[model samples]
Target: MKNRNIDFSMVLALTVHDMKNSLGMLLNSLDELRMENENTFDDSSKFNTLQYEAERIHNDLVQLLGIYRLGENNLSAHVEEHFVPDFLSEHLARHTPLLKGLDIECSIVAEDINGFFDADLLTGVLNNTINNAIRYTKTRIRLTANEQDGYLVIGVEDDGEGYPEHMQHSGTLSFKSLDFNTGSTSLGLLFVSAVADLHCEGERTGHIKLHNGGPLGGGVFELWLP
Candidate 1:
């Protein structure tokens, strides 16, 4: 008899892919339910909780798949030019329902400018960041984008208790340093960092910055793309 070895990473990727698809279907159903009971669901905390949790899980699965691809060197930014304000507005629109249900006032403040970067990758990064902001924001969240020092700076600011001092830093974060046991794995940051690093122009590559104090007076997450 011969023994065969199994590829655990492959198995995990396949499982996560399946889970992501299933969650997509679940989200669609949730959206349908919300539409059917629009008046009641908007004011129902339980419905809001269900939508929030489902969206969070969907985002997690997306990040996991992205991380897996990064490890395999199969992920790269497909940079393209995009109108900043319109891009930000469309992304925020997807979460309007959930944001309204939570009574969180979300808005975009991007200037009239064009950015050159992978839209899909940026969407993934923003999806996770916005969801995190929704989780902690008291009553307001702002999405802003503008050019600074020859780089495009996109920020997510929330009026929640700012990021802990330990997480406040600049540069691309390493997944190796993440502590899963702490309940704050910072996995989203890792994925964001990976996406940011993929954008490059000349000697400048992208990176992420975490700090406190913005228009929101809370955590500010900025992605700098060159």
Candidate 2:
């Protein structure tokens, strides 16, 4: 067998590596602000704004990382069994300060549900979904998990103006397509799709879909993993 040279795209991926480092610094600064003025504002609203922006930065970083992984073909799924409720609670705790700040209440209901999954990638995907829910939701968002047909279905639902009917069926990032000039890049959607696709083994794989009708009667993001 002959030895082959490594590809150059891996080196190019490093060019976009600044986002994570800068965002991390920004999050650290926001943490300091939260501690210094735990009661400075009327409510946690100020910290909420800080948290929302920080979360945005974080989601962008996640997308950047995913892109790098894809370029290197190193984005592999690492699934392990875990309790859904505990996982949801842990992520919520990490973002609680920001949620309370943004005036969005999050409720997670994952009773009697457990599954195997790639924790780190799933965390990033859920964070993006929750961030979008927070952006469009009027007041509340719910995370629900249940087992169906030998698959674990996790949903992020919001209470706000739902997506257009046509957008849901397009199977593309309709929001980004419609508003290309806006700041809402399709990075998060791309990250979600990549993570979902990575969760494949033999004939079974995880998949995700977008819907507009659910208990919340707004946008619903569902991920199904077998």
Candidate 1, residues 1-226, lDDT tens digits: the string is: 7777889999999999999999989988988888898999999999999989999999999999999999999999998999999999998988998898889999888889999999999999999999999998999999999999999999999999999999998998888889988998988889999999999999899999999999889999999999
Cα-based RMSD of candidate 1: 1.1
Clashing pairs in 2: 48-101
Determine which window of 10 residues in candidate 1 has minimal summed lDDT: 1-10
Collision count for each candidate, in order? 0, 1
lDDT of each: 0.93, 0.77
lDDT of 1 at 119: 95
TM-score of 2: 0.83
Residues 1-226 of candidate 2: C-alpha lDDT, one tens digit per residue: 7767766665555654666677778877876777677676327665576678777877887777786787568888888999998998888776676676666789997868788889999999888888888888999899999988777888899999987664473233422354556554566777777777777667777777887978888999888788
- Model 1 regions more than 4 Å off: none
